[model samples]
Target: MTLYRQLIIFTVVLFLLLFTGTWYAKLANTRTFLTDQLESHVQDTATSLALSVSPHVAQKDLTTVEGMINALFDRGYYQRITYTDPRGEVLIDRTLPVKVEDVPQWFVKLVPLKTPEAEADVMAGWNQGGTILVKSHPGYAYETLWNEVISMTVWFAGCAVFMLAAVGIGLKLLLKPLAAVERQADALGRGEYELQDPLPRTREFKSVAEAMNRMTVKVKEMFGEQAARAEGLQERAYHDPLTGIGNRRYFETQVGADLGEGQGRGLLILARVHALEALNTERGLQAGDELLKRVALLLQEAVSGYGDAVLSRLTGGDFGIFLPHHSSAEAEIVATEIASELGRLARERLSLSDNIANLGVAAYEGSVTLSRLLSEADLALSAAQSKGANGWELRAVSGESALPMGQQQWKESLVKALEERRVTLDAQAVIANTKERGVRQLELFARIAQEDGTALDAALFLPIAERLKLVSAIDRMVIEEALRFDFRSIGVERIAVNISPTSLEDEAFRGWLHGYLKGLPAGAPHINFEFSEFAAVQHLEMIREFAAAVRACGHGIGLDHYGRSFSKLGYLKSLRPEYVKIDRAYTGELLSGENDSGFYVASLCSVAHSIDIAVVAEGVESEEQAAVLKELNLDAMQGYFFGRPRPLSSFTAA
Candidate 1:
């Protein structure tokens, strides 16, 4: 029960006990007093009658005594009157039958009043003779007891009502402080850490209130300190402090997260100012920085919309944006607007002799990772820069007539590469450092050999393949070829295959992969599919579905270039991949003077380990970097210093 109800019940019970005891005591005392009064009246009447009838007895006047008895009855002071002779025989008796309506028979029987009888000895001139007996009636005594009980009941009921009202009011006043404490607790639950108001004068309540207020203040201070620290870290990680726009790191992180969620079609616009180095040389650093800031502002204003869009300064004169759910047409519109805004802002603010800004727009249909997007946008921006001042261009579609001949030729070559399965798998050996045991795991890399016997590096052809929407088909072909290679004969337990973001976006690719892997020979537990952090994050839902399908077929998922994003780490818990490869940018600088890189790498390792995610250090070229990574409890290492990329047949021969 609630406290209020319990208190009221307790008070009522206490009152009833006291009231019942008081009533019982008063009733007993009243009964005793009435009995004494009746006894006294009986004695006095009997003595007086005996004295008055002594002369009559001596004169032999029985009639006079009988007449006196009748007179007493006429007085109506009793229900019964009797006079007895000295010989123990009744001389006169007067008794009336009980009336039905006078009093209840049960009540009369329960509270029977015993009126005492008194006797007086009558003597004639000093001679002892017969006794004169007189008895008092019980009805008069019962009447007196009933009147006393009625008065006591009235007093008790009045006191009980007053006590109940007083107790109820007092309890409410006493619990008011507790109610305030409850309200404060509720507010705290809602993340409001304000202290409760002052409580009442009750000592217990005052102490409790003070303690609660102190706790609230301490918790608020702690959270404030944490928030401040988080904000400081965010500023260092995400913002270009000088320009007040997002930094390159922040831009990369945001794009990675957007791609991971597959929230919108990936569209990135990279804007760069041509001749920035020359401009700085000619106009000085101050003017150049000011111009860059103006450009950033212009870019920010251009992409402003209800949906998610971010503009960030990636470098000195380069700015980047990731627009959500934007189509190719929408991207072109935004690019035009940005180009116009940049021109206007330059003319208004820079006081430039000529317009110096160039904008490059690139839109991806499905999942596109930050690295791929950056490379494509950069390529487009370079094209614009080469064309001279104020010239802006959207990245050329592979088959579009606008593409240069070289790009068009490259697109045809990539298509030919796919049809002929000219793509060859190159394996880089990732060897664990040990004197007694040297086991190598191959990291699968793709190389495209043309029909003319000219091999193309992924650095050149992969971006073109992605631009032409041919990456997924190329990635699928690579996986199929890797599975065909007998890695067991090469003394390798596992091989890693790189999967592009576009590959994950292809729903049919996952089904084909599942069907192919299901036919793999039993006990072949060595094939692992690797995805870059940017690519994996771009198509997280698809990646998850693909990962599940792969694992079902005895393969596992590994995240490459991990920690390249600034999004929530919660997805890592859900993905729960076999391993996370630390980004090369971080691992490559492990031996350098940059302590923050090591710390960041270590923090990622810690977080991943907490969720049972094994950490691998990518680009660990030096023994020193490898040692440091090992000290951080990294699970694996890969770099050119350990092994270089070679053809699959060469790997098998080794």
Candidate 2:
């Protein structure tokens, strides 16, 4: 039971006990007083009557005495009256049969009032004529006692009601702090570190609040520490200590993973130092080591702005750079720049003869083996070596079509879509493992209306939009559309939208969003901004900064496609998103029982739960999948099992 209810019941029970005890005591006292008064009243009446009848007795007028008794008896003053002679013979006797009126039989039985009899001597001028006995009727006493009892009960009941109201309100106020403490405990369980805003003044509650606050602080710190440790361990395993970039093992895993996900076209650049062994032989190993380190630095610097690129030290004198979405031209430019930096390092500092680097850049299309990519890169390197001293070659695959729309065409199309407000939101529900009336959150997928009046799924155009540098604009438009939506009409508590990592880099977009949210009227539902883990990790600081600012404005921030990054889970503590949506790829693996995929998800959930972040499995298409995900302790899920994404307007009626 809740503490509040327990207290209320206790108070009520105690009040009832006190009221019952007091009422019983007063009832007993009133009955005793009434009974004593009856006895005294009868005695006084008998003595006075005896004296009045004595004159009649002295005149030997028995008829007069009998008349007086008859008069008193008819008035209902006495139950019985009798005059007996000194020889104990009954002279004049009067009795009335019992009659009960109005009062309930139960009341009469519960509070029985008995008649009291009194006796006195009647004198006939100095001699006793006979003894006079009188008894008071209990009917009047019962009526009087019942009325007094009712009045006292009514008064006490009124007082009890008033007292209960006053006490209930006072107790609620006093225990209000405990309510705060209870909420705090729930928040902690939810993985939120919400602090108690107003410290309770009550000493016991204050102590409990302080203790809970302390525990919360400690738990947050502990999760952070755990994340840091895990991040560190994972980084050491995958990262190159010398260059502070990814190592060979990490590089292959990332490239293979991305390829497995069907990244059709991307650039693979491999650079090798020229004659590293000869250099180390001629100019000490330290100088050679320094050159290698410098080259790694330059390669890393060159790939900086290309979001989600992998730079790794493949070997002692070889380094590799992989860009997921770069074109052939862009890859060449980055490689050429890296070549230039190496030339500078060797000529200006290392004092090495000839060009210091040989660059091989290969662009591939469609699904290809990792060995095929490496072979192409090697051929390009050989071709480069055949050229000038500071040489570079690009091996490009033709006949592989990229996005059908060009940059200008995409710009025109998206601009028209935005200007005409052609974009509409289609929503899919993310439901808890437990069934509920509403969803955990509504994932709003943006669709753009084409010239032909057909709507293009966001998946078809968002990449194009991102490439055109208009992703932020589209994102902003989506936000505006969602804001205009009546969430109440849609019957949803929260809605989430996917955010481009490129957009997070836009200061203007963040500013516009802040102002936009600020302009919303009070009690408007907040839009949940979600980012892909792939993009989020690329710009952690940006995500961290933007997340803080946006959440402060009464919105939620979450991770989309979580666990795809293959990075340490350490950043989760820092990002502290409200929840994470597991990528669909992972969800597909749940068909197998106790597999690596399931274990990975379980581990992910463990770390996520430690930080109080809810893990949701996406792409659940069957009951079996849902059941498996739920067994994995996934808090919620989004997939075809619930229903396909429908027009946002349809959600309201649903």
Q: RMSD for each model, in Å, please?
A: 15.9, 7.5
Score candidate 2 by TM-score against the native. 0.67
TM-score of each: 0.56, 0.67
Residue 304 C-alpha lDDT in model 1:
55
Q: Model 2's lDDT to the true fold?
A: 0.79
- The residue pairs in collision within model 1 are 86-130, 86-131, 259-537, 259-538, 260-537, 260-538
Candidate 1: worst-modelled 10 consecutive residues by lDDT: 396-405
What C-alpha lDDT does candidate 1 achieve relative to the native structure?
0.71
lDDT of 1 by residue, 1-654 (tens): 868889999999999999999888888787788888888988887788778778887787889977876887677555566666666787777876534244556766767677687878776668654676667777766766777777889999999899999998999888888878888877665446667664568888999999989988876675455444434554676679868878886676556645643323546888777667777888899888888877777776776542256678888877788775455666668877776676666566473545667777777654456677778877888787766656666763322112223467877888987888898877787666444326546788888897767566564567567768898898888887887777777677888888776766777876787777888787564677887776666678878887887887777889887765445555775576888888775675567576666667767776676556778777767778777877787777877667767788776446
Give model 1's TM-score versus the native structure: 0.56
Cα lDDT, model 1, residue 317: 76
Lowest lDDT sum, 10 consecutive residues, model 2, at 397-406
lDDT of each: 0.71, 0.79
Candidate 2 ranges with C-alpha deviation above 4 Å: 60-110, 119-121, 126-133, 137-184, 192-229, 282-286, 332-354, 364-369, 381-393, 399-405, 412-461, 467-530, 537-603, 612-654
Best by lDDT: 2
